[model samples]
Target: MTPLTLQTPEEHPFAQFVRILGKGKRGARALTREEAREAMGMLLDGRVEDTQLGAFLMLLRHKEESPEELAGFTEALRERLRAPALAVDIDWPSYAGKKRHLPWFLLAAKCLAASGLKVFMHGGGAHTAGRLYTEQLLGPLGIPLCRDWAQAEHALANGGLAFMPLGDWAPALQRMIDLRNTLGLRSPIHSLARILNPLGARLGLQSIFHPGYQAVHREASQLLGDTAIVIKGDGGEIEANPDSPCHLYGTAAGLNWDEEWPALAAQRHVKPATLEPEQLLEVWRGEAEDSYGEKAVLATLALALRGLGRAREAAFAEAAALWQGRDRAAL
Candidate 1:
């Protein structure tokens, strides 16, 4: 007979949680991070129902999630999509796309790689659900959506870039993502998936939805003690908050969310610039191929400038100037 993989919600949860809530009537058992990951696996695998899943998810969120809980959530994400090691020397993944107008993620990847920096970009595939996703946007740059770990590693090592589609790499998490409609709010899985460090790479890039998540994500990353660019997405992007030039630095220390942000770094917002998907797509394509000329010049130019404060903005032109040299072009 085959050994059974038990469902997490059906099993034990809240060992760390027990201190506040006290021991349960349901026998002395506790779930580890891996166990929590496994339980999430079950939920994503369709082994659990709507009510049961909601209870488990909300319980953790309402009760105040522990580091262990967060770790378990990431573990499940890793289990579903195993981390791929890269020969390249960068720790992190950048989500693609910009809200109003900037494929700054692509610009960042290209110039950083040219300047001898490595970057891993994950999730370039179309959203199975309604949310606007990044995978499809990088197509303009000929950056293919990596379908598996093998492809991802190869791409990062050779191209200094990688794309991990959620649907393909982490199906269990995908299942949890599907529940967003029924639950009517983001769950632990959504938050966990966003903050995931599958490569153990410290310094990856992230675009977040809520300012409130700053502390939770900051604490988690600080525990890992690796620096990462945690930015509020301009268009749900993992790029900088173009409107505000402040970058949130989170490691295994604490939240830097309170730092004073700057506004002078970004160019004037071309407000009401683009809501048309067609126009947006056209701009993205133009930026990738350098077709928009001066209007879209700074998008890629900002890639080479990565210092703190307004000083970084001044050097943008000089950085963009480097990519024009004949010998510097990347294949």
Candidate 2:
């Protein structure tokens, strides 16, 4: 009897999610919100196998994540975050590193922080080549790099700004991001991380490089009951390109709207031959002049202001004032 016994391998619990997405062309469809939440929770909890994780991520990359999926993934992440009860006004996520220009949006965040707004900025490491990441420049910019929730709390409570690496708070998400090299393509974690707003900030600022993702982010923000702005920003960062008209998609007070911001320059500015991190310091220290850089900073600042409930004209004006009045020696 023992020699004649036979057994079948038991199916993995996480296999169902992979099957949901890889069920052939017609049979496959997007995961529902509840399914997304369950799958993300399983991944974040380390319940998913490595093979299953890779396949699931690639499946999502092929179809792109929907608003419901994004919202659900964000909800799962928020449930596991060790974030403090901080009065953060702005949630600034920097994932797409700068390629053509210096990160002018970093200055925009600094200006907001200097003006007494609690700005919580988070980003992953430089996983890709030839791009300037936020964490790389935070030290040079004099922004506090928080490694944990306690440090982040202290930094925001005292200096009104904090930059935390993704790995510190969400190691699973960071691990997924690091898979970019192994997978040879970016996964949906990049998009999911953008709208995290982990501390429940009043305003979330998101940037997308791919066309059509702006609407996804805006709608996902609405689903999450978060006030947020989405833009096709400079180099896929939340920095406005002063050389072109910027279109904004966002939700506020339970209403969605769109606005077009006119170009700040008549002629498109040429990208710098090379990016110099020190230039950020030079411009902030009042030791150098960069017309394009300054305009980009101001325009990005205006975008954040608008997301925070300021009107168009007033937001631009206030952004300029904030720049002009910034303590030159603060950095």
Candidate 3:
């Protein structure tokens, strides 16, 4: 293992990734499959420092990581952590957490649970957007944060919910998260974190703000040969929308897997009313009109379970019912 103190840019695996990202359309040789994997390896071993980490992050954010790079980085990061025992686990890679009202990814989690799905929601402890994040949302739902690797793994196995706080699990990479504020620029780490899957679950859900991600996610699933469900989640988190049909992507074997999801749901898209924290919480807590709050969550969890293109709406409904039951049990 390269000691964090001895690591330098040239020796770091992230070096090539920094190059591809830094050149900003000028870098020679867009990283090939193997090279992309090597760069991801650097991330896992802690060879990248704050400045280089920041630089590569920004460069990729500017250029947007290639689908190949995204998959490679995901492979490297997931390999470092303990793979989950189950093939089915809801691991949503949510990039946008601090939304204006409340981030509803946790509600997504509850919906999936109601459908009898297990979820692993991960995020940074704090971000500059000045709104509470997943950590705060989970607190109201009785999910406790895990501080160590063993505890996190145990949570995934024994409990349906676990929080992989980036600050606690990967501090070096976490340091780069703060650079977003100092430079006021987004970076590759932002995308990478949302793609990071500790459990290495074959089926997972991810969301992104950049529309470019639709293509990238499709490519990533194919390159890695992992069956994953991808969504342009509402505001970059893995929550469904009542306003529109969020297109889905399937990926496996370094190629986009068969995307059997409908251009539209089996049914028509209904208008989800604009919601606030109070109106949404009961739905989030599974206590109110659940069409949006409940359905959104279930969709994510069901996608995690049903593989590429199985029973989309029904799986979503199942997830909602599972979490709704959990919510009632607490009462």
Model 2, 150: alpha-carbon shift in Å? 0.9
lDDT of each: 0.53, 0.93, 0.62
Candidate 1 matches the true fold with a TM-score of: 0.67
What tens digits encode model 3's per-residue C-alpha lDDT throughout 1-331? Answer: 9766765545654565667656645554456667767876775577777677666666666666787787777776666665435444666654466453346557556545444556776786566555556776566665658787667666655656777688776665676676777879766777677666666655667777677776676677666666676777767776655445567676655446443443224454454344355555666444577444455555555655566345767766656556556555442
Which candidate number maximizes TM-score? Answer: 2
**Whole-model lDDT for model 1 versus the true structure?**
0.53
- Candidate 3's displacement at residue 328, Å, is 1.3
Q: Point out where model 2 deviates above 4 Å.
A: 1-3
* lDDT (10s digit) by residue, model 2, range 194-274: 999999999999999789999999999999999999999998899999999999998987789999889999898888999
Residue 54 in candidate 2 has what lDDT?
Answer: 96
Report how far residue 226 has shifted in candidate 2, in Å: 0.3
lDDT of 1 by residue, 1-331 (tens): 9999987564334323333223354542445556666676676567665666666766655555555666666656556655556544343344333445545445455655555555656653443354345565557555656778788777777766666767676666666656666777656665666667667653545556566565666666655554545556565555554455545544433434343346444456555454333443343334334233223334323422432222344546555564454132232
Please give the distance, in angstroms, between residue 327's alpha carbon in candidate 3 and its true position after superposition. Answer: 4.1
- RMSD to the native, candidate 3? 6.6
Q: Write down the RMSD of all candidates, one decimal each.
A: 7.4, 1.1, 6.6
* Sliding window of 10 residues with minimal summed lDDT for model 3: 257-266
Candidate 3 global CA lDDT score: 0.62
